[model samples]
Target: MESRKHIRSFVNQTWQLRYGAPVDDATNQIIWSFIVAVLSLGAWAGAVHSGSLPVTYGRKKALLFNNVVAIVAALIMLFSRTAQSFEMILLGRFLYGYNVGLGLSVHLMYLGECSPKKLRGVMTLTGSIFIGFGKVMGQIIGIKELMGTEEMWPYLLAISGVPAVLQFVTLLFFPETPRYLYIDKGDAEGSKKALQWLWQEDNLKLELDDMQKERESTQGEKAKTVKDVLTSRCVRWQLLTLIIPCAGVQLCGINALYFYAFDIFRESGVPEDQMHYLSIGLGATELITVTLCSFLIDRAGRKKLMGYGYLLMGVTMCALTVMLSIKDLNSWVPYVNIALIFCVICIYGLGPSGVSMALPADLFLQAWRPSAYVISGTVNWLCMFLVGMLFGYIVNGLGQFCFLIFVAYTILSAAFLIYFVPETKGKTMIEIMEDFNKLNFKNRAADTEKTDVDLATQF
Candidate 1:
């Protein structure tokens, strides 16, 4: 984002002005990084509550409520200068991050359940595409030619509220997700009407049949909380599926790639002035590839796409490590490293980035879905925080060899997903669960025995 790095000097100047003297520069650096990094921490904080809010308020109302939080954050940043409190900016960023954390998690659930089986993947992946678009727009607007200047920086930061405002207004025109209506609320007629409105068709018999089966499957199951999700063994494999891949999304060095892309390009002997353009090019590549994936997902299937994405990323990292190690010995190899980095980004956008975000919704049913979101969201946010905090240290400590760590991560993640995770692209929710059942439920009789013994011990 423009505010991520470009706003640094401007914000530092404002701090100096507010203090009426020069201050320790390292303190300013730490504070600025904390303000930027705290968003993910706030996201992790909000994730624990993500699923419950949607469950309690219904998806539409929950999002509307989140929009208010975003508005509050924007107002705080807008008035931070007047109050002469840098802490306000930190508070605003945290609240903004919280809003995003909740929005990103629940929006996928809303999209997955609202869409027909055929369009579900694309609909859910639209979130990633939107994010990519936002990143590009932010970068463009944050350029020196635009609002990245000191006087306009506050407006640039405060402008984040615009999307929330628009979403709040536009989402009002949309109806509640049909699955939430039918499955969670048990409103058959209401669900049917929502489906009709959303799909613009009256014949939803086949769609409703899928919801009916899911409802039957969860017929009398009580509501589950975060504690319930953590303690349940029935969802162990499902939990792993949701977690490993989602965490893998970050561990694959996505943030590192973007955060240190300039360094990478510089090391590759790219001209200084052109490096930013090259960086922008990579961002565009991500946006375009993710957009392509959104179209291809239903046809290609999630397991194949995700598996190969990680596979390709692992393979590219292998080459990158070799290139980084050997580039000092040759003149042309830096270009090869640059190309491989681009290749990794392309593959990442194709599968891991969008697919990981959509997986929890596909992997769980109504009864366990909320808990799955909580766990998966927590993993997603935690990994994001870890990556933000530790990546610079890892890069500094390991030098060029640092990529090998990610290579190992990618290879293992790819292997697990290919062999263990099922394809959920065209499958109904019931059918996806059935596929997982075949893999995880093979030893169900033994599991039941273990469950009984454990229950007895508790008494």
Candidate 2:
């Protein structure tokens, strides 16, 4: 879908094959938006199953299966142009969405479980780095000089399958996560071998000791369901912590900003032909910022980086609203809007983009982690769907004021991180849960006692 904006005109040109007449741009755009928005809907549906598939099949196998969906989506999309059917393209988008929903959750789970505590933040953040990289690559490939032309657009859209195929082949040799083997499957020897394979070390006593303690704490508890995550009093703060940041990822308006980038570039007097290059720059900015954050996350801590990222994003967004409002008042004002847009993306990449993805893995233990990811992935896709579908209306109705709504959301989410969510940097899962229990069990006098899944079950 990253290439959708660039390939849209080409895609619209194909509608004549179905109608036997050229469609008006208005009708074409309506259909186009549906094609784009349907991906989020599919992602939401896939996220609902993200928890169970990984829990039942294990993360590695779940991800391998997910790659097959991406392959199927690619095959369908590749033939849509030849078939002269836009419906094939729509179905392809939905399948791609489903692949992403499951991939995002299971990918995070697999990496998080495999990471040593000291390197966890950095390891998990690699996902954000790759996502940013993929966006930039999509934009680069979507350039008219490459595959964005009408004749090549279908092949460009189908390119996602190539990577899926590559991953499916390469991932077979990799070990399942040590945490999953030890804690979830109760296979101590298998876990030790996995740990050795992952870390390239013979001395894993300390690591296995930690996993044993975690396994004991979560003993007798099954992998939790999404309903359990929502309804349990034991993880109330953890759920809130996961929900707000995930929601903030969409509600913060960064995607909307990207959606409106061409308009912003137009208002700033950039040549229409040059706008795609600028879009690539925007993606590059985020990739660079997230890479920097990956290094800083463990040192500066998740809460501080996330809180400040949102706070700074709120400030940048407020400035952007003013800049957009006054663009006609001064010749240079529009350029400042462009700069502020970059700043907001940088701030988002620095904090919320990467940190939000790590929250579920950080906050929940083995039994609860799967369902926590379900909640995280669900909020993410749902909010993305709502915003993607309604943002055009919001811009038409509110104009520059649309950003103020995002500012409010960013500020509120920032405050929540600062006041409530604990920093997970360098902390063991047990330690992180204890920090959360201080808030979850704040009203109970017995909060001083050790926290366990059994206690959560008793509630």
Candidate 3:
């Protein structure tokens, strides 16, 4: 979807043919924004159901089913230009978004369950690594030498289906996550087999014992509903922990930075023709940072990485605003602004972008996991949709100061994590749950202590 920026002109041309007239700039901007934003709308729709599908079909099968949606969307994109129908593009974008929404949640759930506690943080951040990898691939493929040409744009749009097909074929051979098989389905033998298949190790007594303990703990709880997750007082801090970081991933202005990358690059004296290549460089910076994050997350712990990551990003954004303000003061200032842009992306990829995805999986046990993911995905896509729709106005209204909005948000998110969220690295789900319980019931605990004091005074 990041690739859409390169293909926007081609898409506009296709719509122009459909309109049978010259499309004015204003109308074209609206159409383009709708095309970009519509995917988030579809993702919001798909996220609402992300929880149910995994519970009903199991993670592997649900993900396999989600791939079908992508294939179908791909076919729509493949023929959209031939059909001369912009509506096909919209439909295709929406379906792709839906596929992403479902895939993102379920993929995280599957992997989180599959990972051992020792390697859970590392494995979870791997998902973020690939997400950045995908953006890099998109940028690379969308360059003019490849499919960014007007004649090849439709093929570019449809190319996502190839990976979907690949995953569908490859996923059939792998068993469902062992935790899901054991805890959710109560098939200890099947879970053992899955563990063997996944790990290629027969000495699995400890892993099995852990799952058994978790299963016993969650014996009677069914999968939680979204309402159950939202309204339940017991998990209040868990919900806050999930909600703040997930929402911050979108609200932090990284997407807006990408949306306005060309303008920023142009202002910095990058040639228009070379801007696409610079975009690839931008994507690569995040890819590298996230790859490093995968190594550091377990050692550094989630709270520090995310808390400090946001703090540093806030500082960087402030610097970016200052640089943008002073770009005309010296020729070298624009170059400094460009460097700060890359700095912001690096901080984001290391912290909120990667760690946020792991929170739902870490915070909730099996019964609450699905609903937790649904809320996470909903906040994610909804914020994305809003950013996509409103960022243009933000840029026009606030100009360089637009970054300050994200700066404030990033600082507050950092404070929330530092003050409220606990470190999840090297902790069992039960242990992590206990950590949140203190905060969850802190008020009640305080009340009880106050009553004890009152009773002592009376006595």
**Top TM-score model:** 3
- Model 2 collision count: 0
RMSD (Å) per prediction: 4.2, 4.4, 2.3
Query: Where does candidate 2 stray beyond 4 Å?
Result: 1-20, 24-27, 446-459
Residue 9 of model 1 has an lDDT of: 57
Candidate 3 lDDT, 1-459, residue by residue in tens: 334654566556776676777778897778887887899989988888889999998999999999999999999989987787778989999999999999999998988999888889888888899988898998898777777776788888899999999999999998999998999999999999999998889999988887888899889889889999899988999999999889999898898777667777898778777877888899899999999998888999999999999999999889888878877888888778778888889998888889998898899989999999899999999988788778878989999899899989999999999987889999888889889989999999999999999999999
Point out the worst 10-residue segment of candidate 3 by lDDT. Answer: 1-10
Per-model TM values vs. the true structure: 0.93, 0.93, 0.94
Q: Candidate 2 on 349-451: residue-level lDDT in tens?
A: 9999998888888889999998898889899999988887788899899988998999999999899999878788888888888898888878673633545
Residue 267 error, candidate 1, Å: 3.5
lDDT of 1 by residue, 327-409 (tens): 88887877787787788899999999988888878888887887788787788888888888888899899977777888889
Q: Which should have the higher lDDT, number 1 or number 3?
A: 3
Error of 1 at 53 (Å): 0.8
Decoy 3 TM-score against native: 0.94
Off by over 4 Å in 3: 1-26, 449-459
